[model samples]
Target: MVTKLPLAVLLSASMLLSGCTVVDLDENGQPILPKDPAAKASFSSQTPQQIAQENWDSRVLKGAQDRALTWNDMKNKSTALKAETSSSVFVKATGTVTAVSDDAERERLLTVTINGESVPVAIGPVIRSNAIRDAAGFKFEEFTNQVQFARLTKALNQQNVQQLPKIDGSWVGKPVQLTLAVTLQPQRIEDAVAVVIKQEQP
Candidate 1:
């Protein structure tokens, strides 16, 4: 008769014999997977759900602030390119609200004139882009799998829209200051998602 060990026992023994460490400790407790040294650390331990549980309050805000540039500087192509990571960047701009999209639209946006350029800030019931996620400095390469990364990006976008206070006609014609996270494919400024909007200080 042949004897068989439980699946769990076999797996544990395999890991022990392989001498594989689950995480490298310096990383914030995410499990090691799909090791790629050419880029930043990648992990497999944490699921999109686990990371998304905290919502927009996670490190995204600080990351955006720390890596942002003034609107004037970012408007220059070379400067913006240098600031980009994974083809996105964070920009801090002070602008006058030039126009606000109709509330009836499912995808609403606030058009702000930053240095005389009309830039659309999506204050959304529906946000359709990955600008916020890309601008926060996270690259797609850092994720172990595409499905999880896509799910995480979707969760991040939802959290982003949810984090905003209500937008209304009252906000039009107001001067606002914001650190905007944008993608850099043609106009997006960042890949790591971070956005902070505040009334401009006089």
Candidate 2:
């Protein structure tokens, strides 16, 4: 007499022998579904959910593209194309506060040059510390502005790249470079602070 095996046990045995299906992983860790041969000839195959997911993912990384113009990229592109310097500012200076009478009322405008382009930047006349005083410190207004600049730098660095630029058919065989564009406005901060500027007596 032939005995009938339980349906559940038979299904489990088949699955074990066949091995459960594994999805393929793409470069971005996304699961790539197998393309069906039968579906190739068919029309109207895409679903609404798939379209929605694509749109949602595209919007998430838009900001990364805007803030990623690095100096190296500009320099490299500058060689190939005409590039212009837009914003340059002298963020810090340690020279003696000369002519602090009328100009002391507002921030002093100083010319900052980068790549031979001169940029005018205004710096605060507020003195955080006096040379005559034993303790040296930055003035309140200038100190606050410096803090704001630091925060902006931090925020931009943490941003993610959203969408990459489009590549054409001509460059299909060529290798393309992907780089982070971090354009920091030129600001002369405290690279190294000196308490005293020594001069040799002639």
Which of the numbered candidates is closest to the native, going by highest TM-score? 1
The 10 consecutive residues of candidate 1 with the worst lDDT sum are: 185-194
Estimate the overall C-alpha local distance difference test score of candidate 2: 0.30
lDDT of 1 by residue, 1-202 (tens): 9999999999999999899655554467665575556664354667775665553455577767677877666656434354334355677878888887888997788888788877888777777777766666566676777887777777777777777767778888899888777666434433323266777666
lDDT for each candidate structure? 0.68, 0.30
Clashes of each: 20, 5
Residue 91, candidate 1: C-alpha displacement in angstroms? 0.9
Global Cα lDDT for candidate 1: 0.68
lDDT tens digits, residue span 62-156, model 2: 32233333434444433443234322111122121112123434433333233343333222232221111111111223222444433323222
